[model samples]
Target: MSFFAGIKAKWNAKMDKVLKIGDFDKQLTEIIADGVVTNNELETIKRLIQEYGLTEKDLNIVGVKAFRAAFKAMMSDNIITQQEESDLLAIKDILCVQNELVTKEMAVLLEHQELRNIQNGILPVIETGGILLQRDEQVHFLLDCSLREERVVRRSYQGGSQGVSVRVAKGVSFRVGQHKGRMVSERDVVVVDTGNLAVTNKRIMFLGSQKSFDVIYKQLIGYQVYSNGLDVHTSTGKTRQIIFDNKQFKADVLQLILDRVTIQ
Candidate 1:
């Protein structure tokens, strides 16, 4: 018999022998140190719990610790495989863990998976509620973003006199040949709309409250990645950008743009 099996046999043979809760927790900690909780280990834990008269509630602390260890182990490489995800979900089912964390982590993991799928050419045309997609196009990232673009506004300083003039009399002034009044055509960055910024296999699309655009990969001249957003340039003489203020999928979006989109 194996070591744990032999220990179980001996403990079973001794009728008066009992296992302590702390000892059980320590054993569980050791088992989860490798970031994997095997089926046999789980079974052994269940049997030990029954044999020692310990409730699942009593093991809550150790269970959460084990789950966290497994989660960290999966995240150490920055990618959560299907098996690792399965392991975490299993642990969550067995333990009373925080639901919010699992939900958020699962979402991020799904996004990671979608990005991978895009790279592998196994894309899916998912149904998005806020925007419409063309046939055979797949969206890898769709997020709420604020659209900002350069606009020409003939700006003029109005609080004070900005006209070039010459003093002719005590209280009256003679204006110069042509007083432009400080008005000039200058481009200013302004938030024009709120919308969904979507990166797809074929194009980058923006469906906004006040505007919408679709720029195909062939039209892309260049792109820029920021700490919180992305900007794409097209060859159509018009440039626009959107700010999402989120860092979660920035890398994935950048990778997608770099991979399929042709930069001129």
Candidate 2:
């Protein structure tokens, strides 16, 4: 009906023909059947891509479905082991050779799996909090305000009336009694100066006092390390700089981010 849709349908038809001739679909099924894409399998895939003159779009059309099947096979046990993660990464890397878009799709799948790991409490996390602000799940803290602070405010008020006597025109006198009232109020305010940062299998999340942020591994474009903190750059043209009390944690965090990014 639409121009792009028509093109896509034509492309899919062409790819279907190519796939059948090369038996690419069957080969892909065999490769991922064991939840691992062996070297021989990878070589065969590369050969098929070359022999069929398959473009990145063609690979994407085929690879995504095949990757999903492989992932499901890997997750059939309801748990993803370190070995399984490694195997998935290997398969994703070979797919990346076909197109950059493949990298993004793989990252999303991996991130979803990693998110599941975090939800299951199987992923390790670093808990620290002095969080002043949060955007989404991304937490922000001031380096100088790494320590928590609390303050209390108190207020008091009192009112009183003295007794009085009044005489009316009819020579009647009336006396009024006085009363007093007092009130006090107190409120406690708390400020957070640290937050927990977790690098799960798929994304980086900062849990802060006021807010939190989640930056998926795919969205992270780059990072700059500083003596006191690090600045994370994302594909959305935003940078988040975080300060940690312990400088060593910066290295650990950077490594974790790189590990997640490199796999895809």
**Winning model by lDDT:** 1
Q: Write the per-residue lDDT of candidate 1 for residues 1-264, one digit (tens) a residue.
A: 899999988888554333466787677678667777778876776777677666666666566776777677778888776677777777766655666746666676677677666566655455677666677766766778889988885666544444578988899987766533444577888899988888777788888878988888888887887767777888987778778765554666466545654432
| CA-RMSD of model 1 | 8.4
For residue 100, model 1's alpha carbon misses the true position, in angstroms, by 5.9
In candidate 1, stretches whose alpha carbon ends up further than 4 angstroms from where it belongs are: 1-19, 36-47, 50-53, 94-124, 128-135, 138-140, 153-186, 245-264
Candidate 2 structure quality by residue, lDDT tens digits, 130-247? 4332343332122221322334577776676676988875888887886776776676634444565555445666666675676876788877665565666889987666666763
Judge candidate 1 at residue 133 and give its lDDT.
Answer: 66
Best by TM-score: 1
Q: Please give the distance, in angstroms, between residue 89's alpha carbon in candidate 2 and its true position after superposition.
A: 2.2
Candidate 1: the clashing residue pairs are none
Model 2 alpha-carbon drift over 4 Å, by segment: 1-16, 19-23, 26-57, 68-80, 97-148, 153-183, 192-264
